[model samples]
Target: MISSISTNQIKYVLALEKTGSFSEAADLCFVTQSTLSIMIKKLENQCNLILFDRKSKPITLTKEGEELINQLKLIYQEFEVLQEIIQGTNQEFYGNLRIGIIPTLAPFLLPLFLNKLVTNYPNINFSIDEITTQEITKRIKTRELDIGILSLPIEDQELIQTSLFNESFLIYDASGTFSRNKKYKIKDIDVSRLWLLEESHCLSSQIEKICLLKKMDTSKHNLEFKSGSILSLLELVNMNKGLTLLPKLATLQKNLIKPSYIFNLVNPIPAREIGIITHPNFSKKRLLDILEIEIKKSVKPLLDKTKRIQLINPY
Candidate 1:
């Protein structure tokens, strides 16, 4: 009877992809060059396809090999997860939790929670990737990430979202360019003078939704920042006499000791729904619950009185 493909053979192919040469792949795997080559040949024979172009000096994957390599990646990821489950059943939350966080949320959010998370759960290792919102959603859907932290309205029906809390956006007008009004609407502010983070940040999307800046022209003086930390951006606004949006968490951290008048948005105040997302098949319920609890505890003391006044309840 034909045996199924072994993980070792699969690993050999992955190593070859990385090293680009059989000799190097063998060194990485701690095996002889011929052994690595033979195993790859065996895999090719079993699949009845030439995995590598033998004529090529550096060795490139054939079209079929390229496809096979992609499948191998998925398979390897599954294997690691399965192994983690088996090993962790009798232990602590003692495995790598691969997570993706959007660039907008990473700076302020992680600082508040990461220290306690590491100290409390030493076994729960983290492999975090800071990516765009679209990439985070894609990774969560594909099971490439164990969880994702992002803003709400993730339209994928297959994934599950657990709302953490809502972080309100407060207007920052350091140069006193924006009129000191207790309540402001989108039309009240000069669109040209408003500084905003560049596109790809989910905050930009949320701000666009609130201010109706959909097609409004903005000034080139508004620096195009990639992150939504808003701390440095607020500093720039203070120095340069422009206005930008600040998430409650960003304003609360370290700096921002100046006296600036804060205004609230009329009616539906601008807020981003912070939440954790996971796939339906993820089975670490107890661990995730503890993580949620820790996040809430860490986040509470940092919120300002105004930010707390309009609590954006999570859906």
Candidate 2:
């Protein structure tokens, strides 16, 4: 009888991808180099394909090998879920809960709720990844991440979003150019002096859209700077005498500048709907409910909420 691909063989391939060298992969898989190579060769023979480019120094995956590895990842995930299902039937959310949070939210939000979350659920093991919104969505779909805290309208039909809060943008000035007004107009502001996070961050894209700066050619400007860290931008704003917009939660953090410099956007105030996103098939109902309640308790009191805030459409 023809044998099926073994889980150990699949693991060897994944380890090789991570390590890039067979010796390192063998060390990780706790086997001799010959043993690991033999197992992979067996898998290749069973499938009748060359899984690796033997001519390459560290060995890159062949086109067919890449496709096969993707399927292997799915199979491995299913095996884990099957085990979780059996164990979860009797336990009460005591195992590791994998979570991903966007860069914009992780710094400000974690400080507010992480301590309380750990104190209350001491038994619950938590592993969190600070990543981009797009990455979070991809990982959740593949069952790599259980939950994500990010600005919403993920727009993926496979994911379920639960609104947690609405965070409005606040204009923080250090350039000494912006005057204190109840309302600020985007056009009136100097786009040249505007400091923004890098394009990889969803928040920066949201700001670009709302301000009608979609085609804003920053290259012509005498100075160009893009940062991924809000805290870094805040420091640069103060040092370089520049200006930037900040999310409500970020403004509440440690700031060298005074509050008198902060201003709000006028009618139809621009905001991003912050929410928890999970796979539709994720079976962590009790855990999700508890986390939602805890997060709301920590954040709601600090937020200056209003019906006037408009969620920017993520196009």
Candidate 3:
């Protein structure tokens, strides 16, 4: 009975599952809304199962529909793998690659390798979304995103993580609270005057762990501001005479207000492991290999190698 179903029908069903709205799903599948609807209805008739509950605001799958969709996702992933294997044999590289990166890493890291990567492989269309670690993980699992670049180690067992490099955290002290000549220890930092990204960002959690700020009162500072951008955090830190922790790459931005404000941690230096993640069944081995090599090469010279380091988990 399954042999009667066409691949296009499967594609439409999965697209609808990914996007609840019929119009949105049609856009993804590059078909008219009516065409997509009819195809899905035909699929439902063939299977003799009421798949989506159309009465719902944003259409939702029934219990049986959910189970079938799970199997369909695995089957579609295999289809992707087969296509990638066939494409690998060809010398020309051309495909759509969707990537999700954590906001903390996106700005600093993208500049290092993205431009060259795009220019070198004009045939491959690249789409990047700067999002949180949780969103990145969710998108990768759903096959919405082809790859993720973020801090390690994510606890999800369904994904594969490849370590790229270890980036140490640095003190961005606009308050002159710490001497420039000395390597600052965690105990040296005053929690009261410390600034941080909003709690949603994984970097903020990692920084809190590194400094053991969980038990301390972070609201003791004169001003209480939560910013999403590292650039904004820097500006606020300078204006309010406060300090914040920054990943090493963020400190390398060209237009930072004061280069003298950045300070390294005392040994062993607190760091985060930066890496790429993909679903276990991801098939773009060539793209993954290329990205790993380019990113490592770009950051190798800029990252400090002499210090003893301890990794902070983002989760």
Candidate 4:
């Protein structure tokens, strides 16, 4: 009969790898260093491998140990997948949901239903991180995050994306060169006078594609300020007497960015399809469904794409 490895032992190995210290790893596992050391020794005996270099200060994993740790990560993730599948089938929503949200959407979207999720699913815990699209995409792939709320149709084959809602972009023009309630075309954008979020933001890429904004001659617009936040972008536009594309949800009354300054795109009304992204291995269907539902319920009435709206592919 094959000797069964303890899950706790696997967890200890992972903790030790993460902290690179016996005592710290033991503290993380809520055990004494000697206890954790015994567990590691037992695991080594069972697996017939030397897992760590205890002689090294702040212990290092041996070459064989590195290989085993990689295997252990895969095994642990698969074990977690099994647990999630069972919990999903049992309708038990009692695990931590590590979620990553892109900055452009986080401010507007999270306020709509985050509180509701906490209130409704009291058993579920949340570890919400405000991250950039690139960061979240990488995190989702590594299983660091359970879900990612980001702009959809990511080209990654490893991620399974679920359509949430279509968010229409509104042009915020402080100079009023474009008429209010008028439909503007992408070609109509004065790239020199346009204010955009920084390169790190996915929305910046989307806007760049939608507006066909390339390298502009700085002589027309003096300073170059690539803002990281939508709010910051708005301020830059206001101060520079420029224009920017903003999502409908972001232009809410509370934001104080004036509805009269907002304009819809015509000819091909450009919008982005926002969705919930997850790793293919992720199996928290119950938690995923609830979060998706809550977001849709809150934002649907405000951003009903059933009306005339054209979508632009940012990818």
lDDT to native, each model: 0.74, 0.82, 0.88, 0.83
Each candidate structure's count of clashing pairs:
0, 0, 0, 0
lDDT by residue for model 1 over 92-182, one digit each (tens)? 7678788788766787788887887777667888888888778888887788988888877588778889988777777766666556545
How many Å off is the CA of 113 in candidate 2?
1.1
Candidate 4 wrong stretches, greater than 4 Å: 1-91, 214-220, 306-308
Q: Pick the candidate with the highest TM-score.
A: 3
Residue pairs in candidate 1 whose N, alpha carbon or C atoms collide under 3 angstroms? none
Segments of candidate 2 deviating more than 4 angstroms? 1-91, 224-226
Candidate 1, overall lDDT?
0.74
Candidate 4 lDDT over residue span 78-133, tens digit each:
99999888767554667789999988888889988999888766777888999987
> What is the Cα-based TM-score of model 2?
0.68
lDDT of 2 by residue, 181-236 (tens): 44676666677777778788988888787777975566744656677888787877
Residue-level error in angstroms, candidate 1, position 170: 0.5
For model 1 the TM-score comes to 0.62
Q: In lDDT terms, how accurate is model 3?
A: 0.88
Clashing pairs in 2: none
Which stretch of 10 consecutive residues in model 1 shows the poorest summed lDDT? 306-315
